[model samples]
Target: MPAIPPRFSVTPEEIDRVVATFYASVREHPGLGPVFAAHVKDWPAHEVKIAAFWRNAILYERGYDGNPMAVHQEAGNVRPGMFDPWLGLFDSVLRHELAPETAAQWSALAHRIGRGLRYGLVEAATLPGGIPKLV
Candidate 1:
C-alpha cells in the first residue's frame, strides 16, 4: 500500500477560510454565479461540501469519497466555461491561505481533480441528438 503523505498542516479554520474566499470570488464572477445558481440552490450547505472537498484533497481525509465527476456529470449540472475559472479561483484561494509549498502541492492535485470534473461537465453539457431527455 502507498504510504500516506505527511498529514496536511492546515487547520480546519484555514480550510474553511480557503473555501470562504473561493466562494466569495465565485459569487462575484458573472460567469460563475448563474451556472452555479441554475444548478445549486442552497449556498450554505454547498459551502460545507466545498470545505469537505478541500480537506479530503489536501489532507487525505476520508469524508469526501464520491467520484467528483460522476456526481456532477450524472446530475447534468455545471457549465463547461465555469469549470476552468472555478479551478483558477480555487487555486488562488489556496495560495492566499496556505504556505507556498502547501499551495504548490495542493494546486497540482486540484488540477488533476478539476480535470476529472471537467470531463464530467463536458459529458453532461454535450449530450448528443439534442439536449438529453429525461427517461
Candidate 2:
C-alpha cells in the first residue's frame, strides 16, 4: 500500500470528524440504532467520550480512561455479531473521509479493536461454561 501523503495528517480534529461522522451513520442504522439508543441516554456526552476514546486509541493522547469491556458487558443488546456491521460502517466512513493510506491504517486499527471487544464479550458470556461438550 502507498504511504500517507505528506500533506495528510491524522490530527485530533480528524479523529473527531471521523468519530462524529461514523456515529451519525450509526444512528441511522437499523441494526445498531436501537442498541445504542438503549445504552446511550445523552448523545452529546457520549459523543465527547467517544471522541476522546478515538483520540486516545489512534493518537495515543492518554485521555480516555474508561473500561470498554465493562461498558460492553453492561450493554445487553450488543451481540458479538454486531461488530461486523459496526466495523463495516466505521470502515465506510474512514474510506470516505480519509486518504487511502490513512483509511487503511485506521480501518486496520478499528478491526483489531473490534475483534478484541467481541472476543472479550464472548469470553465474558461463556466463562466456566467451558466451550460446551463436543457431542
Residue 127 miss distance in model 2 (angstroms): 4.9
User: How well does each candidate superpose onto the true structure, as a TM-score?
Assistant: 0.75, 0.86
Please write out the lDDT profile of model 2 over residues 20-104, one tens digit for every residue: 8988898999999889988889887888899898777766666787999889988776678999999999999999989999999
Query: lDDT per residue, candidate 1, 1-135, as tens digits?
Result: 985773457777788887788877888888877767776687788888878877777677777755667667665546556667888888888888899887777778778877877766765665586475444
Candidate 2, lDDT over the whole model: 0.83
Show model 1 residue runs off by greater than 4 Å. 1-8, 75-77, 123-135
Please give the CA lDDT of all the candidate structures.
0.74, 0.83
Candidate 2: where are CA atoms >4 Å away? 1-9, 127-135
Model 1: lowest-lDDT 10 consecutive positions: 126-135
* RMSD (Å) per prediction: 4.0, 5.5
